[model samples]
Target: MKAYAVLVPGLAASAPADADVRAFTETYEYSTQPEGTTSVQLWHTARRVTWDEDYAEEFEHRIEIKHGVSEHWDVATSTVLVQSGRNGLTLDRVVLGPRYRFADRAEWPVDVTLALEAGKVADRSIYPLELRVVAARDIDSLTLAANGIVGVQVGADVIDEVDLAIGWAAGASYQLHNKLRIGAETWGGTADEGPRPPTDGVNASVGPVVHVAPSSKLWVTGTAGFGLTDNADVVAV
Candidate 1:
């Protein structure tokens, strides 16, 4: 008879991960657009975790806001709440991060970004620092992108190493119309701990993604992931 606290992130599916790109595992999009740009997005994520041999469910609601400080700098903030079988409803985590894009920003076929994030959950705080690289090329009506991600975490009750995670994501999308696109993405991450291989405790998932833009300023995106590893949650939507 044991229990674990489920922690979820407060971020939109389109939240930027790097200079430019979006994947199921992470976003490689730039931190800032142009100097006077701002946007907000609301997202919902449902996750199911297996406890012992049984299943437990959790739901998260996230509200994220981003503001561009300059052409190469942008800041983002998010707040999230989770409802779980054991905790009922409670604050999950709050995250604030800044991103810096190098070279030609999002238009570069290969772009790089440095991001720093701090999160607070309960009485514990964690900071994650990451370097993300994105390479994308357009082939006719289709776009293909690949991302390489590496990050480290430090804080109380968390890992304090320099290389805590190594992950990658690949995406292919077809533009069906002026306002719509459909794609599939796969992402995987491995934790660096103990003597196991880099992917020993890996959490891997893959699913389809859709993006819709009804107007210039409004966008809607959704994706679902099915776990491919025993360590991963069964399903996420």
Candidate 2:
């Protein structure tokens, strides 16, 4: 028997601050990384195609923030949480205000996000303002997901619309040891245009997730993958 190197990214999903992005062409769907720090990650996969090993690779770096603590309330009568703060949910950052959790939890867990486009990184490209409305449901062995986003470029009239970024990924994980698990997972996403659609693009990934929980509050993860099609990137920049 032979042992192989397995990737381990611990229980980061439990409290990842900015973990929902399935609702647009620009946001990422799911990541096992936690909030309040930055991480650079790379992944690759090799497949035996035509008796030869073909390979694909991807890499990405992300900065995440879990800014505030939210209080949840229950309102069974009207089915809405009484506003405890000023934030409300909308795709345009249409409004930048506090949001209150309904007294009772909605059928799904919800998070509202607003990307302030107050500055530009470059002179040629104007970073657009994006608003995200995301909801997710997780069960014992399966997870459910859906999201919607509205993107607006400051000066570009060509980009503005109510777009739903929707997709799902599922797999049952098995622990092979006290600190390692092996399993296959996959997800797909597309930008469905509303009246004004964002730039058209497709994002999806399929491979394995190495799950580990090292201590009470620390875990690390790595994902390696190969694109099923040549159209996918050798390195997703």
Candidate 3:
């Protein structure tokens, strides 16, 4: 589940305009808030896993605050809370990131954005760094987007070498009404101590998604994802 709330008015003060069209729950689009505007987003995710004869559940809650510094640049920070099995909910990590768009919509064949983020996890010496290339294209009422992601784990604790991960996310959505859009998305990734084949230690999922904007100030999005590999969770929402 995902919810977006606009706290400040900018170029437009209406639904679908006030907030970017969030077509996929896991994939991000190439749109930024107008300069001087601010927005808040809340996200919740649940996963179920089975190991031997035991079943465990995990929950994650995230809150993000974003501010636009210019037409093409924006910065955001996120706090994550996590709960696993019978453990109590606790702070897990905090991440800070900045995103910059290369050109305005329709200025090029596809709009592109560069995003970089750093995160610190609780009680862990290893820190996480991520870089993503976001690309999207709009054709009438239909939109297509994709993201290429790379991540690294660095810290004093790493013995031999740092860990590396790579992934990709893609989605397509079509506006059915002024306040509603329907879409589908797929994402997968693999990680190890260094570069390796994509089939190694890989997990993947595919899902259908929906976005609804009931009012000018609020927007909601949801997705039902199913695992495609044995290493992935059975289902996620």
| Best-performing candidate as measured by TM-score | 3
lDDT for residue 148 in candidate 2, whole number 0-100: 53
Off by over 4 Å in 2: 1-59, 72-120, 129-135, 141-183, 187-203, 235-237
Best-first order by lDDT? 3, 1, 2
TM-score of 1: 0.75
Query: Which has the higher TM-score value, candidate number 2 or candidate number 3?
Result: 3
Q: What are the lDDT figures for the candidates, one per model? A: 0.62, 0.33, 0.79
lDDT at 102, model 2: 31
Better of 1 and 3 by TM-score: 3
Best by lDDT: 3
Candidate 3 residues 2-43, lDDT tens each? 555555555344323634546678888989766777777788
Q: What is the TM-score of each candidate against the true structure?
A: 0.75, 0.41, 0.89
lDDT tens digits, residues 1-237, model 2?
A: 011211223423344433321211222232222332222222222222122223222112222222223333111101111111233422221122222333232343543222222223233243344444434443443433343545445543324343234444444355566455455554444543112233455545556555554543333444443334332232221
The residue-by-residue lDDT of candidate 1 on 10-122, one tens digit each, is: 32234342322232223344334434456666777777744443545778877777666877777878887788657677777888877777766337665566666666765
With candidate 1 superimposed using the best TM-score fit, by how many Å does residue 90's alpha carbon deviate from the native? 1.7
- Candidate 1: regions farther than 4 A off: 1-25, 51-53, 105-109, 159-163, 191-199
Better of 1 and 3 by lDDT: 3
Clashing pairs in 3: none
